[model samples]
Target: MVIRYSFDSLQPRPIDLPTEVPLDDEADLSVLDEAKILAAPASRADVERWRDQIERWREEARSRLCYSGAQYDRIESQWAQTCFAVAQVWLWDELLYSFEDHVFTPQKFLADARQRLGGLDAVVLWHAYPVIGLDDRNQWDYYRQIPGLKELIAQFHAAGVRVGVDYNPWDTQTRRGKADVEELAALVADLGADAVFLDTLKTAEPELVEALERAKPGIVLEGESRVLLARIEDHGASWAQFFADSPVPGVLKSHFFERRHMLHHVRRWHRDHSEEIQSAWVNGVGLMMWEVVFGVWVGWNKRDRSTAARMLTLQRSLSHFLLEGQFTPLVECADNADDKLVFGSSWKRGTDTLYALVNRSEIPITLKPIREETGIVQLDLMTGAVAQHLAITIPARGIAAVMTSQGEINPDMIELASEVSAIELSDDARFEHRRVHRVHESSRSKNTGESGVLIEPGEYVLTVRYRGRETGMYDGAPYVDEWKPLVPRLHDPRTLERVTTLDNPVIVAQHEVTNDEFLHFVRESGYQPAVSNRFLLHVKDGVNGRGHEPVCFVSLEDARAYCEWVGGRLPTEDEWQIAGDKQGFQRLEPHVWNWTESEYSDGRSRFAILKGGSDAQYDESEWYFDAGVRPPDFSAKLLLMGLGMSRSERIGFRVAFDRRNK
Candidate 1:
């Protein structure tokens, strides 16, 4: 049997490119709305035909669907049009949550967003998934259990950044809850979420739509990728993930169909975002900034971040033109030659017209926009100043905008120019890399009792094996700069030969610590976690009969505390691997994964390495964390979270004692 990458289903579906065949007037035009990009005809003679055909299709589709677009006109849903830059923030991102303080720091997150991505118009508090199913806690519990999440949302609202909560329809295996629609509606109402991001669904079922609307009138529903044509009426926005564009720059189908329907272009794993930024600018849509993808760091390059900042500044200021103006895709610049790599779009409303341009080449190119009327004030959007000359030079792989208005320019445009004038266009597009470093356990224990197996200190070469999940074993992004990573390269069983040097002798516990052992430690030491939301949650349900079972529902910190109380420390991943290689290292009955002291952080994301697979595994999907018992060399990366959420019923820990000076 051939195992394919598509089996993992990690990547989005292939983009639907435009058809080159000419369409008859009677052709069903509704099918055209499914295209990722409405490509321009290559021949000049067919340009008019291509444009007319699309217009006719839109008219026909609208008539057939009875499209009123009342959703866009709603005063409540109006925010969707202006929400240009939304950050898909991991709930536990370092900037958002302080692990040390055990608190959610919305101010820090907001400040960073403003500085780097030119201020986010909204943020999707991405919870669950890539970490869910570790235990029975459902998706809603992840959000509702947070201590100050409501206050956090309030802070974001105060900063003018709307909050969006994610809805994962795939979470059917976890602890049962109300119907997804009812739970999602209640969650939205409770948190005052401005939008609900359909994680994997292109559109929510009609039942969900109605429920959410009743929960929060004017609530926006944003689908994951391409939303169906008919569903676009209610879906205020859609995520343009992995959308491949045409060479001549094409129009976004959904945006073209309804100008107010926002589509945020995003390629999560790609470091260089020039293509997405350019697409968003030309289409007058939005961009989704997912710096920390799940638990991996796929941060935006400085060049792209600056480009987004500049693009958004103008987009926000002259949004009136972008939203209400008559739009023309691939407008011809006055001095643009056929050979030039620059492309631009023109948005015209009354006497004012705004031109958004992008240079696809590696060198700056100057272009002159057609001056149809005399005495028009040309404001250089890049510099936020008046254009000294008609010829505007766009930096290599950069974006620019020019607002040409009759008489006086709008105060918003002038303010936008002033805001962006201070921003220096960055030429550096280098990927900002962060290496994941293992955090060594600071608290060590002296070797005393020989209750466990003793391993003589020596360097050992171990063959480590793991399933290549998207969360990456220990460090770096699993897929970088790849359009889409498929099977063989994704979610396949992988092997690595690692030579680990252990200078000091140590004794690794033969079996994981039992529930009774941890209970005694907690009772004797009276250890109380600072933010004890889910600490030792199983204890409340009764750990009495499970005294001999491996202790579960304890975080790495909690495990470390227990091990320290026993005058021992949690073994490092290498130490445990070596011990596992030696016979007699037993897994407790009803096996649970052991937490190694291999916590790592790349600043933005923090994760820990787990060894010795557990019996509890959710085998229904590849997106779930690695499961089933395995060899000592097998390892899994668990993204660490604060507020005791890391504590799981499927995970436990053992101890290692360092040999004291003899």
Candidate 2:
């Protein structure tokens, strides 16, 4: 009687399949013994020879079919299939036995295969069972012997090749359930395998997919060909395969081949069915050459030296074809048979589109007019003479690659302004003209004499003067205190909090007027007023000629409105900082205050005020005040005092000219 089976069923069958036969049962036990003997003390020379042979074969195969597109696809499919079959068979047979006793040496096979292949891109080891030896009671003990496997892996990695392992999560000897599969997948990911070979056993494709997602999310998964193909066909898991032929517009058919024969197949297929394949799969074709010939399998003999060589050659040729234009999908097959084929990676740099072209036919072909807005194009891979116009002819089976140019901005043209000068205030005392004027030289002239010199437009360091109390009375009594403090105490908390120290030497009075600053700019310039009708009355108590009193009381619209009047605009925060004072005061002296263009308090307070003081008050303020006290309120004032003066309430002002105006 025939038995019906669902695709999802995981039940074991009554009979063991031929594919599951033990190595000792099928092959001579002596062959296993010989491998064991040879591998027992495998020499460095033995390993090198195998590596050389593999490299030589690969080089030869790649050179032979460098231009064959069809051959490349066919061999790729074959290689993938071979890897899947070998991996599955190995898992079914030899992995359960201990290499120390069974004489199934994976290292010996790898050394031989390496010599045959010339150079391996990578090696993959398939471990079928969780535990290798029957005598090994602890499962972890079986893994301790993996150091030998790791050595081989390290060798390949040092040679610029990657090494991977096949993880069979369903093996009952190692794992008993779904949870075990998950744990094993996580372990494989943690091992950092270059590639993972997954088998479809008791686990379903969906479960495998989920396991991969949860465990090794970023790692490359090399699925069994039959399992992947069947999943795509029956279970609707198209993403299982790297290349699915269904969704791609014109794909006719796809297959897997060994890497050894891929080059030959690609060339022959390109020659014979290039038109059909190109017509059907216009999105370009994908070829898979899994690592079966890398001497990773213990069940099969190492791949023939010739086979390894052929695979390398095929890979090189395919890479060259991809770089050239031959591999591009025929997006729209024109009626003209001479239409050129395009090839390109799906990567983009910027606005420019990149295209790789090749002439498949014997005759030369010229590409149609490419759009100018596509930007100027340059060939990244060109070695010959360069030209603005791409006029060179691509010979038969030759490639041409081109990418658009990226533009850059000139650094030399950007100009930066100099720092703003610090505001320095003159003494509030009377100005006296003297050739060395002295106070009390004429006791009656004291009220009429000045203490400091006058300031000119270029630059000056002015000092404020204050009166000190006399110690005793005499014809002309000498005072105990010489100079009065710069900052005077103010009764209003808001006014006192705004004062700043004179630490910053340089200060600018006014920020270059934004429309806001110029709105109050009653000063005469030759240009007609942008906003002539709007009148600004000079308030009496307000600091006049002090454009630097942190231009305030202006609306946002008014600030912007004034900028047009002065033929200048508001400074950006960066520009304002550059021009304004940055240094903190050491003492309580008010320097000339400057107006900044920045909006403070979220534009609710439309101005930023800056002040500076001397070093004497630095230690004095903390003794009586907390850190939270607002700095002396010179925010709205135009003048700032020096270190020892008592008139801190009188805020000073200074002026700044826009360099842009000059």
Candidate 3:
């Protein structure tokens, strides 16, 4: 019982590579160097111009906040109107407070005029303190004294404004390990508070998270402070705090005053512990700012409010940035000791990457060079300055955003290939005793036997090779067979029913498309792969020797996209079968199981396609060790060739095409 396979019928259309351009002998390398030198100054100017152009582009790109330009404009206009309304109320409240003659609490004034102001994302309650010890004191006393606190909460909730309470954890109220912490939390929850702030609890104990969850299931929890308690715990600090009897010289420097200091502190906290912060945020906790009042104070009294305003604006901007979606931090850089000269944070949004950098120190920091074509936009968080390419010097305590457009690269352009060579098996009586045999020039010619069905009609570069032990007769072969043989069967020959199977024999490349190769495809096609569609694939033995390499995680859709881009199509299961030969007995060599064009179980499950031999090892004898064994008498062999296998990490492909009448 033997079956034959063919590769010719499965041929696919071939893509032509670009012709090489010949260089002239007169083209002097030194002249090129001289030209580079001459263009150096001009290049600098060009770079600056390019930066400006990029900035302009970024501004244009952000003209429409999200993707739609018109929708972005509408949203922007609405946001402005809303902000203006809020600003008007804020201005009115400030004036009334200044006059000291207005008879209204902050809560009441904001509440009564809520309808006039457009809906806000969130409503911030400024002065609600928390209850501390069973015996009221400080903020706890204030909380107990305010008869209108509960009413304020109800009013805000009714207005669809999620109320956030501002309470310092160390203020003898919300602090964990305190006598009445649980009681205060319970009371706050009962009052219908949407969220509670534990100011200065940068690293609220894990138990505290559990306690809060238990007290108010699903309630948003937030930690407010710049000390970076969790980060500091993870990465130790080595400085002692000492209070000077006399005031330190630069303690209140004009440049260091106001929210700039706060910004610096916040940047440091985020930079040092971005991962932990992101984790906490995703795990039912929100990050908050308490010293927004500092911005107002700086703006009102300091005459020089630019820095303070920038800081406040950046903080608000970051709040929205971090809360956009779930993210994992990739890189972070910050100065822990000085807390001043630090800044940098980045996250992956879908397929796009977004990054932000802040200049906390008075001196400007030239950031490390970034690739020009990564499609990053530098946004001035404070002024809404957007630039496609950015190299501007941020003013002291300034912030800039770099966002990469999502889904710009085409997944079809990504090309992946395996390093390991394919092998071919044979079914001749001479090779019966030895299941695996190395394919050489002579062997390939001898086993040309017959071609398989042409799965599709076009062009293909198919190379056949084989794997076997190094013997005196087969010297100078490519691969060496290292695995040992299995024991001979003991059952009666007549009683056994022979089961036939065909393994897809073409070995596809290993996991993942390389950065360089992906870049080339993008350059040629101007196509961007959707970030959401791209994935990392993983394989066990596919790594072969390089286990640390990037994994290739792709879907059948991704595979189809690549084939279409390269003028090919996926192979049908029958077509894949026709490419490999069946040897005697149930054993098939070289040809691993290949994916079929047909959907599994009638497409109910997309993953029904067969994969080759178990990459998973069975035993040391057959897969690992190779002790000597004699050849058998009546065995059979077949062309053993490597076949592509679909794996989360292995990047392999099959031939395909549109069916044509023949």
Candidate 4:
């Protein structure tokens, strides 16, 4: 099924014109900085001139900026060039970290990558942010506190995949730590990470570059967007996010300047990826496989996955053609010159010349002849069949490749051909959507002799307020098929009115559960959790002096255990809000978020709605978790993490019971 995009604005502009940079010797190349696609001249004769002008600019720019290729020259750094696929994976993604088992399953993650994505070359283990700044624990603590993370990295290495650690420059308001340079350098070295993904940064400062090198030699730095021209010398790759392509395929500035430099094309929130995949195909660049964006699932369709499998098959086998070959954008088709919907590029190295083509339209296109003048044997690289006329069909929004070689073909190419022949390319372009479901756990229906606020049974419309973040309030993507979410759409004040009906009356506690109250439950019940990590972290010396303070640092399960002992359960989001609307609902001093019986899962992520915001607020950056004292109507969806990382000092719980049970 073709998932029709209702919004015409979200449709890809196949004929989007590119920006032209001046060719003058003294032309300010800074004009080329933010360009999505550089324009290629329509006439064949003028295309040569266009190529020369860009080459001349690169030569002069290098001399003027004093560029150095020392980093790319290293054997360890060269992997980025052929790193065709890198997954921007959340550390707690369901495939990688199991919520039920409470363990990091690297084997499970790797197996999924191998099947769906044709395997990953590297993965950015995205931790913190969207969940960070909940308390004083800084970014480093997020990594350092995780158990067996190093072993997890080793497992990926054993599977022949490198790991990349993410560094967020916007993480300043959290607990003070060593300088960013020192902290990041130490992190990369300790984890033995192959690369560092710089979040919201184009390039690391010169000081940071040097410090990271000193700590771990040959470490690759991959910036968020376009890496600066001069800084591209040290930075191995740039995430070519939101890069729009021309009607006719054009050159990627950084990749054109330095063939070894890698760029992974990605649009985090976009569901359809045909445009970006085609863009990467012609440019011989990589693709970022980020199915789960933060906590939201923006997965690739079957067609896109099949296209990636074919692309990766060719790319992994023919790295020499992509890296060492001379690349020419918009290579002309010998016979089908009028086929505007189909564009091709040629790469030449040694005695071989390869042509890569993409069909941008919805109908299959047949190429009459290609590279016939080469007069050498033309082989369909994808099928391993020799083509006498060099004619082949490129499926709609799919890719095709043909290679002519005067020498013996590499064994790897033969293996790639054999592998791709077995793959049944899927044409189903339907978005695989996951719906979030509220997880319900059975609690004892015993009577608890505790006085509390009563919420009558009725249908009520609650005005729920929350910060509009990438994690949507209840379900669906926050930014649906958007290029880049900005301003009012992102991190803006959002209001949602939920109409809920309660069948039975509820008794909600007026105040949060205190430290002293939780200790008594622990002592009396003698409860022990399946995973003891980060349990009762605030309680020290077998005593918590602050008895009146709300109990914090307890996981959702721990809170449930305490509530079960008292013959009550946590309040539902609706029950909590209804009680808060009453006059008797009093917030405990030193406010902390209250956990509700609102645990939800979309299979990829688990989250619980938190009410009554905490006093701790990390300022200066909007990426931090929602903080500051909020009204009872306010709710924050906190993505639940395994191994007690979900437990926070700023989050607590209170009890509620059904009136009939009490």
Estimate every model's Cα lDDT from 0 to 1. Answer: 0.83, 0.28, 0.30, 0.83
**Superposed model 4: Cα runs more than 4 Å off:** 1-18, 22-30, 33-36, 43-45, 407-412
Q: How many clashes (backbone N, Cα, C below 3 Å) per candidate?
A: 1, 89, 64, 0
* Tens digits of lDDT, candidate 2, 173-214: 321334645655655565554545544331245665566546
Best of the candidates, TM-score: 1
- Candidate 2 stretches with Cα past 4 Å from truth are 1-147, 154-163, 167-183, 186-190, 199-217, 224-348, 358-375, 380-385, 392-399, 406-662
Better of 2 and 3 by TM-score: 3
User: How much lDDT does candidate 2 score?
Assistant: 0.28
Alpha-carbon shift of residue 254 in model 4 (angstroms) = 0.5
Model 2: which ten-residue window has the lowest total lDDT?
A: 413-422
- What TM-score number comes out for model 4? 0.94
- Count: clashes, candidate 2: 89
Ranking by TM-score: 1, 4, 3, 2
User: Can you write out model 3's per-residue Cα lDDT over 1-662, one digit (the tens) per residue?
Assistant: 65343222112111111111113333322222101001111122243343333234334333422322221122211221111111111111232122223222445544433322212334445442110220113344334444445775676556555554545544432223444456556656666655554544533555654565566554444433222322222111111001010110111110011101111111111112222122222111222221112111101111112223333333333443343433322123322312444344455545555454545454546543133555554433323334555444444433434444433422211110010001111112111121222111111111111222333333333322212211111112111121111122101111112232323232212222332343344357755434322233232322323333322344454455554555544554333433433332121222223333433211100122333322222122221211111121111111110011122222233434433334
Would you estimate the TM-scores of all the predictions? 0.95, 0.28, 0.29, 0.94
The Cα RMSD of model 3 versus the native structure comes to: 33.2
